[model samples]
Target: MIELNPLVELIIMNFAVGLIVTISLNIEVGYLRIPQFGRLLAVIVGAVIAAAVPGRILALYLGLPYGAEYADHMYNAKIVIQINNFLSKNLLLSLAVFILTLVLAALAGGVIGYLCAYPALRLKGSYLGITLLTFGEIVTSIAWNYQPLVGGTAGVYMVNPFAFVGSGSSSLAALITLTIAISIYIYAEILARSPFVRMLKAIRDSEVASEVYGKNIVKARAQTLVIGGAIAAVAGALWATYTGRMNVASYTRLTWTFWPWAFMMLGGVGNNLGILVGVLLFTLARTAIIQYKYVITSVIPIAAEWLEYILVGLVIIFVVMFKPQGLMPEKPTLTLPRKAIEEIRKRVEQEQGRL
Candidate 1:
C-alpha cells in the first residue's frame, strides 16, 4: 500500500490551518467591507505570544472555564490533568500567561483594525486593496527583523497547537480543523444573510449613501475590522502551536498571508461557501502539483519551484477573466425564488436603504 509520509501529512495538516485563518479573514475584509491586510501580523503575533506563555500548559491542566466536557470528548483525553502534570510547577501562572496571550492577541487585532478606520474613511475597492497590501508587506518585513518583538527571523518556538493536549493525529486534526473552518464559514454566511451585513454591502457599494441614510459608517467599518482581526489572530495562534515553531521565517511573506487573498478572490469576495470551495480546491491543486512534480517536470521540462508564483498568477488571471463570481456566488439562503426576488426588488425600490 502506498501511503504518504508523516512529514507530507503534517504539511497538509498545517495547510488546513492556513485555510481557516485565510477564509476567516476573508469574511471580514472581502465580504464585510473592512479591507484589512495587516491582519497577517495578528496571526504571527498570536502564535508568538501563545508559544512563549507558560499558562497554555496550565490551561490544559485547569481545563477551559466551561468547555471541559466537550474538550474531553473532542480531545478524547484528560487534557487538563495531562497539561497539569507536564507543567506541574506554577501551573496557575502558566495558565494565566496563556489566557493573557489570547486576550492580548484579540486586543491587538481590534486596535489595528481601529487604526485602519481613518484610512478606510474614503476608501474601498482598489484604493483599499493597495493600502492593505502595503500594510501586509510592512508588517511582514517587521516580522523579518524585529527579532526582539517576535524573536526575529528565527520566530518563536514550542507552542501548543490545540486547545487540549495529545490531539495531533495529522488526518484527524485536518478533518477536525476543516469542520471548524466550515463552522466559521457558516457563521459568516449567517452574517451575510442578516440585514446588518447588508448595510456593510451598502457601504461597500456606496459609503456616502449609507452614511446619508444615518448609518454610522465608522463604527460599522471598525466593528468588522476588529472582528476579522481577532479571528485571524486565533488562527495565527493555532498555526504557531501546530508547528511547534514561531520564527518569522516560518510565517513570513512566502506562506501565511498572500495565499489567503488568492483563495478569497478566487473563491469569490463576499461569498462564504465560495471561500470554502476555493480553499479546498486550491489546496488540492497545490498538493497534486507537488505530488506529481517528477512526472510534471518530465513531461514539461519545467521546475516546480519556478512555477509556483507563475501558476498562482495564471490561476488568478483565470479567475478575473472567467468565473468572476467565484465557484459559488455569494449564495442566497434557502435559494431565493423569483417571487422573493421581485419582492426584494420592490422593497429595494420602495426604500433602497430598507432592502
Candidate 2:
C-alpha cells in the first residue's frame, strides 16, 4: 500500500468539502435562482452544532457538565482524552453519535432556510441577496461575541469521531469526506434529471409563467432553499469532524459564501458537470497558492494572502466578461414526454390563435 503525504491528504479533504458546498450552491442559484448570498448561514449553523452538540452528548454519557468550563484548554483536553478512551471501548456508540451530529446539523439548516424564505418572499434580485448576506453577518457576529456559542472568540475543539481509528484518523476523514462528496454529486445528478428540477428551472426562468401554470413559486423556492441549505450544512458538519475544531472565523463569507459562488459561476451556472469542473479547477488553484505562498511571495512584490484574492478576482472578471454563461452553458430542460410536450404546444398555439 502506498502512503499518502499529509499535505496531499489535507488537499483532498479540502476538495471534498468544496465539492459538497459548490454543488449545494448550484442547486440554489443555478437551478432554483434563489441568489442565496448568505451561503455561510447554513454552514455556520452546522459548525456551531458540531462544536456544541457532540461534546454535550459525550459529556452526558460520561456524566459531566457541558459548557465553556468544560471546553477550556485543560478541561477540553481531558474531556477529549476521556471521550476517545470511551469511544475506543465502544465502537457502535461512536458511529451512532457521528451520524446523529450530521442529522441534527441538516435539520437545523433546513429550518433556518425556511425561516429565511419568509423575509426573502417579499424581496427580489439584489434586495433579497443583500438581506440574506446581512443575516449571515449578524449570526456570525453573535457567534463571535456570545461566549455560550462555541466559546465565542476562543472557539472550541471538537471530539473527533474517527479517534477510534487512531493513527489513520486523517486518512479516514479524507475517505469519509470524499465518499460523502461523491454520494451528493450522484444524488444531485439524479435530481437534475428529474421533473422536480425542471420545475425549479421553470421558476428561475419565468416566475409569472410558472404561476400561471398553477405552480406555487414561493413554495418551490422555499423547498429548493431548504434542500440546498440542508446539504450545505452537511459540508460544515463534515468540516468540523475533519478538523476536530470549530471557529466562527473559519466559516467566513469568503470561504463558505463567495468562493463557492465563484465555483458555481466558473463551472457554469445550472450545470452539474460544470460545477464539478469548476470545483476541481478552483480547489487546485487554491491548494497550489497556499502550498507555494512563501515561494511565490519571495518573487512577487505583493503579500501572499492578497495574491490569492487578486488572482481569484481576475478569474471571476475574465469569466464574467468573456463567458458569462460559464464554461458549460445551461442546456434546455425537457421534463415532459414528447407526446405530452407536443400536445401542450398545440394547446398553446390554439390559445394564441384565439387572441
Candidate 3:
C-alpha cells in the first residue's frame, strides 16, 4: 500500500506535469491550429534542461527548499547511484552544464520546428503531421542508439530533478511545478479566448475566406507555430529537469506528443477548461492502472503486455464514438466587430508606413 503522504505527493506531481504537457500541446492543436506532430521535441528539451541544471544551485536560484530533499536522495543507494551517473557532484560546473544544455536544446528544437514550417507550406492535416513525426522518430532513434545523448536503451538514471536545488523533496518541486503550470495555462487561456485565437479559428474554419477578409493566414500561423514551439520546448526542459534522464525510447511515439494530443482530443480541442479536465482524468486513471498492474496482470492472461496499447486504443475509439467533438467541444467562434477590424487595419498601415 502506498503511504498517504507519498500518494498525495504523486497525484500532485503527476497532475502538475500532465497539465504542463497538455497545455503545450493545446498551443499547437488548438491555438496555432498547426499540424504539429513532433511537439514531444519540446518535452524532451525541457526534461534535459531540468535534469542538467545542478539541483542545489537551481533550488537556490529558483527558491526551492532543498535541504531535506538532498539528504534523503543522498542516503538512498539507488538515487545516489543515479546522481553519480548523470551529474558531477561539484555543483558549479554541473549547473553551468545544465543551463547550457537547456538553452541549446530549446533553440535547436525551436529552429527545427520553424524550418519545418516551410515544408508545412506545401502540406496540411495528417500529411504535415506525418512529416514531423518522421523527424521526431529519427531523432528519438538517434538518441536511443547514441551513448552521449543520454544513455542508450538502458535509460539514463536521473537524480530527482534539481534535488540539490530545492529544499522540500518531491512535494516542494511539485508545488513549484504546479504553480508554473497554472501560470502557463492562464496565459494559454488568455490566448485561447482572445481575438488573436479567434483569428486562428477563422483560418482553421476557412483559410480562403479568412484571406479574402484580409487576414494574413501565413503570418498568423508562423507566429503561432514559433511561440507554441518555443513554449513546448520550455516545457520539455522542465520535464528533463524533473525526471533527470533522457533516453530516446522514452520519447517514442505517443509518450511525449501523442499522449498530450490524446488528452487534448479527449477533452476537446480549442476548449481550455475541457483540456484541464481531460488531463486530470487521464492522469488519475493512468496512475490507478499502474497501482493495480499486478491485479491487471493476474486477471487477464495474455502472451504479452498490451495493456497500454489497449487503453490508448479504447480511449481513441471512445472519444470517436461517443464524443466526436471531444468531451467538451469548443464553442463556435464569433465575428469580430467592424470597429475592431478597422482598428487592426489602421494599426497595420501605421506599422507599414513606419517600416
Q: What is the lDDT of residue 1 in candidate 3?
A: 18
Which scores greater on lDDT, model 1 or model 3? 3
lDDT by residue (tens digit), candidate 3, 92-178: 655565556556655755666577668667887888888878777776676566544344555544545344444454565556667
Order of candidate numbers by lDDT, starting with the best: 2, 3, 1
RMSD of each: 8.7, 5.6, 7.9
Could you give candidate 1's per-residue lDDT for residues 258-304 as a string of tens digits?
A: 77877877887777667777877777777777778898899889987
Spell out the clash pairs found in candidate 1: 54-94, 55-94, 55-95, 60-80, 61-80, 147-152, 154-247, 155-246, 155-247, 156-246
- The order by descending TM-score is 2, 3, 1
lDDT for model 3 comes to 0.67
lDDT of each: 0.63, 0.85, 0.67
Candidate 2 per-residue lDDT over residues 1-355, each given as its tens digit: 2335888887789889999999989988988778789999999988888878888888887987676666565577677777777886777888888889899999988988888889778988899999999988999999888876677777788877777777788688788789989999999999998888988888878889989999998888788889888998899999988887777788799989999988888989999889889988988888888888889988986678887898789888988999998888888865579899999999999999999
Worst 10 residues of 1 by lDDT: 65-74
lDDT (Cα, 0-100) at 93 in candidate 1: 52
TM-scores of all predicted structures: 0.73, 0.91, 0.74
The candidate that wins on lDDT is: 2
Backbone clash count for every predicted candidate, in the order shown: 10, 0, 26
Off by over 4 Å in 3: 1-4, 49-109, 151-161, 164-167, 302-305, 333-355
